[model samples]
Target chain A: MQPYNYPSKYLENAVEEFAKLPGIGRRTALRLVLHLLNKPKEEVEQFSATLNEMVQNIHFCSICHNISDNDICSICSSTSRDKTTICVVETIKDVMSIENTMQYKGLYHVLGGVINPMEGVGPADLNIESLVNRLKSNDINEVIMALSATTEGDTTNFYIYKKIKDYNIVVTTLARGVAFGNELEYTDEITLGRALLNRVKFNNSFSVE
Target chain B: MQPYNYPSKYLENAVEEFAKLPGIGRRTALRLVLHLLNKPKEEVEQFSATLNEMVQNIHFCSICHNISDNDICSICSSTSRDKTTICVVETIKDVMSIENTMQYKGLYHVLGGVINPMEGVGPADLNIESLVNRLKSNDINEVIMALSATTEGDTTNFYIYKKIKDYNIVVTTLARGVAFGNELEYTDEITLGRALLNRVKFNNSFSVE
Candidate 1:
């Protein structure tokens, strides 16, 4: 094929960058770039500015490790939310998923990552220490481990449980709304619902209540 | 829905901003925001930078009106490309589609938009004057109208034909590779090919080839 004669090398460069986005292929990326080119100057400017603003403005809430524009996330700062109970999640997406159900009003503590030795991630790499610290100082009554039901998730859950056992907090996990081997990100609302409903006690080993 | 306890109001604000994308709805925008949140900090930073760079660096080629970072677009600047023939397209995406096939060797002239009365776009608003000027000065021989086969596209074509009739240049349009009312943006490669091959000569008041 002949080399492409893009209007701007930078436009082409941007297309290449967009191509790296999940689910975007080369042709689609090119199409998107061309579409952007056809747009009025102000529209393209807004599109670019929005992306830039998102990155420059948004940040992780230091307390819950959830996304925020400030030091303390909205949920953590809200006086109405139950502060004594913290729902543990592997990622911020999981927090959104749980929030979507409108079932949980407790606080959240994002692990940022799970314990996956295969990926070179260990216990020390996660936000486990912060969670333990929260349990130690606060009147936290329960810790709901709402991680995915994958082997990696189970390992991470167990690891966190061990670290937090010394604290007299009631530790529970989301009932099995997730199917085996599925990541929390991909699990549908129904399955996640079932898993949450079926959550059994974490008695050093995983078993249905 | 209950007020989404998004980690941050800024995150919610960003999600609202993304929701304004052409085809994205609130849910999809939210999904995209969560996806970006999950990305590594460096990747997110790079994504933000890419948008800024694209907006700040990209420009339209003065000659062909194609998007570019320089005074001339790549196609317009290249020595190998046929500068004598200009392919008139409704949008820049049409240019890429034609370029990808490696069949057309001519430079491009992005109209920026098609004539659509419903949308309040008309001839006076288009870059028709520059096109007429290009024909007057350049060694341009043939002007191929590769606009979509929609009523709006036809309206733009006829309007352009009237303006350029006095220039004594060959005027041709994409032989109907697209179906009636189907946007050029949606036409697949094969159909576009068939249409390109079947293009015919166009005139304002006569069907003369």
Candidate 2:
């Protein structure tokens, strides 16, 4: 595509800034900027104000390091949540992904990132120390490593496991198997093998046998 | 999809604002907000500031109705451009698309939008009067209707043609034809028929004979 030559410097600058976002290209950025331009003046101002306010006022949970309005997150302060189990994750996004499942009622401990030597992210760089302090101070009965299925995730999980191995608690990881609704034909060999290795007993609940 | 429940209200508000943009869903909005959260405070501040500044300060070209930094646009003010010819388009985005083509060296007239009765848009609502005033005051030789191929585009084209029929200037439109690089098998009947009816003289540039 030809180099963009927007009519206004402000439009060009705005497009440039929006283009810096992940997965957004110049064309899409221009489209978005034009959409903003068409919006009412107050609405655009409100949009801008919302972002600034969020960035300035947002807080990280003091206990779990998740994004929060207050020092402690809602889940951490809620008495109804399972206080004995803490799910150790790579980032705040993982916590949200798990929460969306509506399955787990336990608390979360965001590591901020995984241990990746290539990226120069070490165990010390993450919120691992804060997690250790939480474990030491609390009567937590279970610690679940809910990181991704990547090498960095595995390394981070192992390091955290070592740090909390002395504790009189059950340490577990997410079950590795064929995902629900996933066809075996499309499953990779390693995942298929793992699914077979950790196969669960067949319980035909739908059958009237 | 599960209902989103971000840890922070600020995060939720920011995501909501971003989700209002075209094609951005709640999930994508959340991802973008989280990405913003990860950026440096100064960078995010700059992003917010840039948007506000653009919305507050951006100008529209008085001559062509395109988005402009100053009173007149570059194309309209440039000395080398063909001032005798004007390509009328539907929006500022259309002007940018023509500019990107690097084809037509003529000036432009942005209608802001085409006539769409179904959407309550009419000639009176657009910059048609301004265009007529420009024609009456200036010595323009030709006017090209470069609007879309939709029914609204055709209606606006005929309306404009009728408005300028009494004027001494020649009026034209973008030729309706089968587009270049389109496969014959997939070409729609009307377009293919139009292409056949308006077939150009054969040129032998590629043949050895």
Model 1 lDDT per residue over A81-134, tens place: 999899999888788889988778999999988898899998899998888888
Clash pairs, candidate 2, are none
For model 1, what is the alpha-carbon lDDT of residue A23?
63
TM-score of each: 0.74, 0.94
Residue-level lDDT tens digits of model 2 in A1-209: 78977788899999999999988899999999999999888998999899999989999998999999998899999999999999998888899889988889999999988999999999889999999899999999999999999989999888989998998889999988778799999999999999889877677433334
lDDT of 1: 0.79
Q: Name model 1 segments beyond 4 Å from true.
A: A1-4, A31-59, A177-209, B1-3, B31-50, B177-209
lDDT of 2 by residue, B1-209 (tens): 87877888899899999999999999888888889999998898899899999988988889999998778888889999999999999999888888887878999999989999999998899999999999999999999999999899999999999889899999998878877689999999989998889877677322324
The per-prediction tally of clashing pairs is 12, 0
Question: Against the true structure, what is model 1's DockQ?
Answer: 0.34
Residue A71 alpha-carbon offset, candidate 1, angstroms: 3.3
Query: Model 1: how far is A89 from its true place, Å?
Result: 1.3
Candidate 2 docking category?
A: high
**Fnat, 2 decimals, each candidate:** 0.49, 0.86
Query: Model 1 Cα displacement at A40 (Å)?
Result: 6.3
